[model samples]
Target: MTFIPIAIYWIIALWGLFSRRPVLVYLFFLSLPFGSFAVVPPALTGGLTFVPTPMTAMLMVGRTFLDPTILMRAISSALDVRRLGLLTGFIVTALVSTVFMPRIFANRVMVIPVRGDVSTAAPLFPTTQNISQMAYLLISFATVIMFSQILKNARMQQTVLLALTWASALTVATGMLDFASQYLPVAPLLDPFRTATYALLVDVELTTGKRVVGLMPEASSFGSLCLSLLCLLYFMRRAIDHDRVRAFYAPVLCALLIAFAWLSTSSATYLGLAAFFAMAALEWIMRFLDSRYNLLRKRYLKAEFAAAALAVVAVAFIMLLHPAILENVSMMVDRMVFQKTETSSFEERNMWTYVSLNALVETWGLGVGIGGTRASNSAVAAISNVGVIGGIFYFGFIIQSLLRSAPPDDKRGQVLIVALRYAFVPTFLVGLLIGTTSDFGAFGAFRYGMLTAIGVTGLYHSSRMRQRRIAVSPESA
Candidate 1:
């Protein structure tokens, strides 16, 4: 079964890598939902299950590195210099932490490993996890450079956008099928796709109904996937090139991803959804203010107005006419968010964060290294794995990217810069609650790269399609 999925991935990966078109862009985005499908079996990797997206990321990095000019161009810019510097500092911290901190605090701290019996935290030690996690961290860091370089070309940027739109649609479709298969006799039919060595929590449930794990190993991951896509698609829709994709496909997929995430019934997803609403509201308000006061309006401002109006009408209708809908929503939120601490899952996850944070302090802030501990919080996971210096470097990179001021002429760059910033918040907030590793995974690196490419090129001069100018025959100026 694993072989079946691996073979399919190979075809996609190979085609993407070798093709003239930006197939690798499509491959990267489409491969993300298969969190449970480990491309390399644990037995082959000596207990490390290398999943598709990370493997694809490594391949993308390798492919990018093959071009000597990318590094040449990357290093020429001050923004790229800082990005590389910060990431270099981050990796150095991880290396030092993996080598020395694990040994220094080996028996001194307790942690729940990313693998092994996750039921309880144990005294930390040097393990294979440290090595594998370092590799993953390296791959993620490399991905930022790889993708940023790739996005320098206008065609590649458009391809990535299209790929994300399609990937979101595919993700929603697969999750819906998974949800429907529960009532049908076809649940086992989909099992072949979920052959990862990790324990698959596909059929977990809350008090209401079966949690929609999709093809992911667990409900939280599946929900997070949906939430991330929803944010990306909604926030970055204007950057998409095609009218059909931007106006119809992306919007429909966003609605479906939102619906599927709700069905997943994850507490983190609920919090993320709330965060999404808040952030979207804040962004819209800011844009509105910018348009009214500063004359710094966005390209598709009317859509935001229309969406906001629809949301109000929908909410009013749901409250006034379909009161039961509001009651059900309230109960869901109650179970998932307000009363989340009461659940055993919450207790277990809480322990993971507690022990991870303790490991941080226990190591005197040296950090126990990546994969030395499992954490339910991204901040705890990031800082605890690499210590304060590494944490600062990692977070500083994010802030730097967000703070980048694009040239006034680069409209696409400016939109992507602002959109990606807001889009990251919902998912990052969710990761703070249930994230396991310091790695932001591939999609995050992709977003970072997209933003970085603008900074890399400085003015997006490689873009051939941004112009609709008709030249006058006589006038040179």
Candidate 2:
């Protein structure tokens, strides 16, 4: 049964490799739902489950090196001295922290380790977990670089959007399967894919009801995955090249993703939803205020405004007729989000962050290494594990990536930049509360890489355009 997933993965890999164009992007996004499926057994990888995303990323990295132009373009995206310097320093510091710092501070600090019995904080020491996590971090970073190079072309950008739309649909399909599996017996079919080394909490239920985990290990993972897709599809819709996809398919997928995310009953996802809507509202407000924007057309504004007004009227009418319905929703929100802090799960997560942060202080901000400590917060996890110096370098690199200037004349590229930025915030916010590891997942790496790639390509094109204009100018003669 397990062979089914492995066979499909290899077939896709071979197809991607032989293809003339970069099909890896399509394969990467499409393979994300198989998160629970380890292509290689844990026993072979020393109890570390290797999933499809990372495996595809490895293929991408190989592709990046195989083509000289691709390698150069990837490097050129970070050619800026400050960006390059920060990235290098981050890599160096993180390597040192992973290899040496834990041994130096062995037994001196208590931390929630990447692996082992993490019910409580344990004494920090060098372990295979550190090496494994560092390896993951490096792979994620390399994936980012590889994506940046591949995504520079406008055609490739459209291809990615199409891939995302299909992937979003698949995500919805998986959630539906998960939801119906409770009543039906088809969940056994999904079992073949749930062969990860770690514990699988797929069937867990929250007070609200069944937590829809989809094909992931837990509700949180599934919910956050939905949230990420929701953000990308919703925010990036205007920039989608295909009219049908942008108008119909994208909207449907976005709606389904939101529904699945809510059904997951994950507090982290709820927070992310709130963050995403807030950003969306802000975008609408901006669009309403200014009509000359690059991506978001004013044509959609009337429908959106009309929808908002209709929704308001309907809500008011519903409240007047059946106030109990409103109360039920409020209670659900309170149960899923507002009262989350009182739960034991929240307490344990809070402690993970607290202890990991204290471990940072214990190591004098040199960090306990990449996998040395665990935290519920992504920021704290990154800073605590990498220490203040590495954090500075890492964050600087991130900021540099996110703040890349779009080409002034390139509307599609500018819209893409806006979409990526707005899409990133929800994921970032959700990760702050429930993220377990410092290493941003493959999806995150891809987004970051795309951001840099878009910006760099825009700059290069704009520069060339300017040079062409100058060459034709009479002043040059």
Q: Each model's TM-score?
A: 0.91, 0.94
Q: Best candidate, lDDT-wise?
A: 2
Candidate 2 per-residue lDDT, tens place, 1-477, comes to 888877878888989877877677788898887779998877788788888888889987896679887777667645554334466577778998998988999999999978778779999999988888888888888887777776787888888889999889888988898899979998888898899988899988756678898888899999999999898888778888688998788877887898899898888999899999999899888777874755444536786678778878998999999999889778878988999989998999999999999999998889999899899999999999899999998888778777776666778877778778888899999989998887887877878777777775345557777898999999999
TM-score: model 1 vs. ground truth: 0.91
Off by over 4 Å in 2: 76-79, 82-85, 291-299, 314-323, 456-469
Worst 10 residues of 1 by lDDT: 461-470
Which lDDT values do the candidates have, in the order given? 0.81, 0.84
Error of 1 at 341 (Å): 1.5
lDDT of 1 by residue, 388-420 (tens): 989998888787677665555777767777888
Shift in Å, residue 198, candidate 1: 1.3
**Largest TM-score belongs to which candidate?**
2
Which residue runs of candidate 1 sit more than 4 Å off their true CA positions? 74-81, 291-297, 456-477
In candidate 2, the residue pairs with backbone N, CA or C atoms under 3 Å apart (3 or more residues apart, or in different chains) clash, namely: none
Query: At residue 245, what lDDT does model 1 achieve?
Result: 85
**Model 1 lDDT vs. the true structure?**
0.81
lDDT of 1 at 305: 79
